[model samples]
Target: MKMDLKSKLLHAVLGAFFAAASPVFAQETPNVVFILADNVGFGDMGPYGGGELRGMPTPITDQLAREGLTLTQFLVEPSCTPSRAALMTGQYSIRNGLSLFIIPGTPNTLPKTAFTMGQLFKDAGYSTAIYGKWHLGIDAQSLPSAHGFDTFYGIPPNTSWDSAATVPGVMLSHSAGDVPEKDLIDKGPWIMEQKAGGELKKVKPFTLEERAKIDVDLTQKSVAFIKEQAAAKKPFFLYLPFSMGHSPNLPSKDFAGKSRIGEYGDKIMEGDHHVGQVFDALKEAGVDDNTIVVFASDNGPTGLEFSNWSALGAPDMGSSGPFRGRLGAGTEGSIRTFAFIRWPGHVKPNTDSYAMFSIMDFLPTFAAILGKELPKDRPIDGVDQTKVLTGESEAGARETLLSFIGADLVAARWKQWRIYFKDEVRTGSGHLQLGGADTGFIDRAYPSVYNIEMDPHEDVNVGGNFIWAMEPALKAVMEYEATLKDHPNPKPANVTNFGGN
Candidate 1:
């Protein structure tokens, strides 16, 4: 059947429209480098508030804040594994079935069916590499290679420098069985083979003094990877999750005593130094302008051994700024964190945005950058905030965020109000009062309300007289919880009970 003149013209017009739009889409692809810092606090950086620790003002991190957009209301899960999982999948930890840190040698792991950011980039013809901690899962099936990373050069699980089998005070991995330390050393490819029971088995022949040198060597390798990828003209996605400032608080000898606040401060400075190396690598490769660099923490400070309360004559080393509570608690202090992004010529410089964002949004945001669409069947709790990052929009992409404290969903942030399903815990070293006793758990039935816009510190709880006013926000939270129940539980494993027997 021959088309009439009107029909033929219509087809020609449609063809031209698609042709014009195709090039615009092709030219929009940009390289992404997501830098995740472990256990970093909101006010830990020099740009934020660390002048007391570093004299004469260290300006490397401060420069990023000056030249990029700072996310004032960014948040993450309370711990490393859940936050990492959320960032990688663009879904909540509960949705992905990885709500807790994956126990070594357990059946629980990030399921192979779920898609990750690395996989998304790899599918789009981008080279992806992760060079740091992979604490989400340690099983063979959950390895970085299987999760869409083209190459991985970091610890497969949470192994540290203190393990006896490794070089004195250097991170190491051992084979996955009861192999002798001597046998592990004999078996080559030293870093990949780790003992099964989370022990570092074979020590490299490096002397005790040489352990600090290993960190430098890792930094060099990471820089080399960036250089190589740039030379090949490949747009790369590098996930650098550093282990510094987490535990054992070890920095190189040169950096030790560099801060007035002791080891904790020294480690913070060292982490900034390593971040500078990554920036230098990008600049050296001539890809700094085109690459989008995002720096954020996995969660709040651990403060177990290096509590600021004890070290600096303060209550905690890492401050959550004006937010209340600390790591592991449901307060803003635990979830709210530092997030900064640099994309030269794209993002506005030295600007602070109050747009509510989260680690859960990274995957979707990256997908938006690459012009990829998420699967419709997979319900993503995160929205593409590329507009907010690029200064095209000012409004927060999310109206509400669900927060999980331990095993239960305890609170939700909606607009200016944060509605807690449980009793709000007191901030800083105070015993949580539940049932007239000192119970550690933040009670959930009382439903405290805080106007975050006015009182970020959460000093006053207005839930008493405003129950009627808070009904809408509280109802929204319940509806969200119900939606999760209707869907298949992403993680089906039993919640491990670690209470004293």
Candidate 2:
């Protein structure tokens, strides 16, 4: 084993060359932690506008913004299930029969054929898991575990934060003689868990009291997952959808009276605390530098008139920043929200991108990063935005995004111009209200166009003066329609069966 200096130097050079060329010697893939906030608004967090003003000081979120890239014109669908469907499938929710929020026992369910973000990561040699809401469906075939997530925890299928509000009192008034309280409780929602290739199992009853503390449990479980993956030295993808921003915004015991505003503010502050905890966990596990942390909202805020649960205190729902309309309407406020990405070394810090980014873009963008090929059989609306994220280009890949409510395309955004094909009006009292419901749409003789950058509130319609804008806007619509010839969307869920077929 005694080698001369010349022989030793030659061996070292050969070893270095092999290490540089071999796939086995490549660097580890980056891990992704995506935290999805439910109905959190553009002006709700500190960096956007409303931190101290709204009595919710989000120091953690502000720090994250400073440490990474902030997306100013980030857009999403108007409601939960549709937005979530877009996020998961990299396409318009209408393509998957989930363009509206899915109600229990309804015909709308996630189609089995639709490919998901989880499956993409799973195929890329990353350990994937989703904790929190799984509103896609309650069916065994449609659960997160079935769709390529290695683990699933939190709310049961098709249920949301309000599922915990059915208590034995004034609101949930059942016929005492006909329906027993015990029987109702047994049939109520519970915190569920499942692993890949396993059946979903209930962990505990998700009562109103449990709802206040569910986000805490979710944070704990997510932290554990992070630590476990770090120890194994495995690349992982964690999707944590927090329940804080949704109405009945009850905070945990520690953050109960922390905010000067009402229950919603308290919950917002609690969300900040949870964000800090996850960041700390990543740092402690020594995976902070290699992990990509993303924070974003599912949609705009819920209105005071809809699902106003003042159980613990006043539900100061949310503010839509400078925009006017709330969750449902096809207005700027309804679709525009906040998004932050902190990819330590890859993304420049304290930078802002005004480029229009869609929630659906995550899937294709992630696919590009992981070197995965997308399925060629289906049409993917999302474009690869790796260049934008890495600062290679200022203008993003997408220029036009079509906004749909259920099966109908209500609006379309092209560059800074928003063209509305239908006028939206909020329904009066005595009308049945849902998240993206209670808003009647009337067909317009000519599409109304608003330069969103100039008219942030959409106050002035320049459709008459800038009638030429209709050509490009309508062209975007026409191009999407042309795709229907080859790849028609699954039949509308309401008219068809539950599977969206």
Name the TM-score of candidate 1. Answer: 0.80
Question: Looking at model 2, which ten-residue stretch has the lowest summed lDDT?
Answer: 492-501
lDDT per residue as tens, model 1, 305-330: 33432334522246566676655666
Error at 88, model 1, angstroms: 0.4
Model 2, residue 149: C-alpha shift (Å): 0.4
TM values, all candidates: 0.80, 0.93
Name the runs in model 2 displaced over 4 angstroms. Answer: 1-8, 17-26, 167-171, 175-178, 311-313, 429-436, 493-501
> Highest lDDT: which candidate?
2
Estimate every model's Cα lDDT from 0 to 1.
Answer: 0.69, 0.86
